[model samples]
Structure formats: C-alpha cells, structure tokens
Target: MSRQLLQEPVQDLLDALTKSEGPDILSTFTTSPKPLAHEHGLPQLAPFLGRSFHGQEGISAYFDLLSTYLQIENMKFEPEETWVIDESCMAIALRGTATFTWKETQHSWEETFAYRIKVAEDVSDDSEKNGSLKVCEYQIWADTGAAYLASLGNLDDMPE
Candidate 1:
C-alpha cells in the first residue's frame, strides 16, 4: 500500500495508546471481543504477578501483563518519541516514560513508560485497497492477542 493510506490509522492508534484508552484502542485492532478475564481478574491479582511467566506468551500478552503492572505501580505515559511508518506494513514506534503515583505496594516502580507497537489494516484478497496498498498480516497478530492471550492456558486456546 502507499505509505499515505496508512497514515491516518497509524496516527489514530498511537493516539489511543498514548492516552491509555483501552477498549477504544483494542477495538480498532481486533475482531474478537476483549476477554473478560483481564478486566475482572487483573486488579485482584496485581500484587502477586511479578513471578508470573510473562515471556511465555506473545507480545500482546506481554502488554496485558505490562498494563496490569503499570496500574499496580501507578505509572502513566509521558511519551518521548512517536514515529509512524508504512514499510511492508503500517507501524508506529513509540517511546515514553511513565509517571507513577506511588501506592503502598511493595513493588519498586519507575516513573516512566516506553513502548513500540505496529498497527496495520487487514487486506484480504477481496479487499478494496489490495492493489493500491500493501497487504498487512494484521489478522495473524490480532487472532493471537484477541483469542490466545485471553485464554492464558491451553484449555482456552483457539484451535488453528
């Protein structure tokens, strides 16, 4: 796709992340519903997750865990660098420091946040812009985050 076509979507997604607008940002990126587990179960387990297996999952899971951790640590985003691009896919790389409101929690917290995410639009064989814009592998990434991370264990993992 021409780099110009991706500009708006990339900017909008980055703005959503910078503002920490949860469902708003997620909806643009996924087809499946946001799983209820992270919403209902996170706050209760916030203080206990440091030893949790983070890297075992993909980047979205990492972000979920990271988001939960930020809430626990009371960190807020203070974006440093924000760049938008359209290479093989539309992407945005953002870096920022999080400012924390210290709570009584024992976890040592930093007053900064840094993140880099790439958001791309799905282009199917029947998509309107298929010939004008680069097709993106967005569905592959979305399927994993929307379906896989919410499950946490194999019992809930979506079958290929």
Candidate 2:
C-alpha cells in the first residue's frame, strides 16, 4: 500500500493512543469479535505488564493496570519515520521525548522507545473509518531498564 493509503489509519491509531482510554482505542484495533492482542505476560518485568490481553475485557484489564501504575505524558511517534513493510506490517520506532511515570512511586523520566504495529483492512462499520485499516498488532519496545527502575522508585537516582 502507498504511504498515503495508511496515513489516515496510522494517525487514527495514534490519536486513540493519545486519548489513552481503553474504549477509545479498542475500536482502532479491530472490529472483529475475537481477541486481537497477543502479549507475553511479563509480570516479573513490570507490575502493569499483563501476560496477554485477549478480547475486549482483557484489553480493559491491561489498560487499567497501566493507568493505575503508570503515566505516559507527551508520548510521541515519528510518523515520517514509519516503515511500512507490505500491506500488513509496519515498523515504527518512537523517536520523541515523553515523560513516563510510575504512579505508585511518583517516579517520572523521559525516555525513547519503539514499537511495531500491524494494520489491515476492516470491512466492518463505516464508523470504523469507512472500511479503512485497523490495527492488528502493536508491540512495544520500551526502555525496560527505565521502567523497572521507575517501578522501584529508583529511576531518578540512576545515573545517565
């Protein structure tokens, strides 16, 4: 697909993320009734990290944990840098500054991260962007070190 064909879907997904509410973003993911997210539940790595968020209910739980424990402020993605690999896959690295806070510890710091996303056409309701693209998978490559330190309330103390 041409980059132009994906601009709307990508922008819509990003907007949903910025909104950061579970319901607001779920539609951006898909219109199918089946579970869409597949994640490796990494509880040992972070408290908010769920093993896998399956369906809508699971998605809600996943976001709840995140909202309860972390605050992502000013998170930005470089659209110009998004690498579209065929029509079903894309790799886009986060190249902007964002303050990530572990809410329980009140630890906040800026970090750069990356994520890979997959988008596909959804022929569901026109309400979902008139059969435009929908996100199939979203994989985050966050700064685990920073996340861990922040979770322990020690990120700020770590030296650059």
lDDT of 1 at 112: 34
Question: What lDDT would each prediction earn against the true structure?
Answer: 0.36, 0.64
- lDDT string for model 1 (7-90, tens) is 555455545555655435443342221111122124233432323221113325645654653443333333323344545745
Q: How would you encode candidate 2's per-residue C-alpha lDDT over 4-65 as one tens digit per residue?
A: 66555556777777765523776666554333454344568786453666655766676787
Q: What TM-score would candidate 1 get against the native? A: 0.39
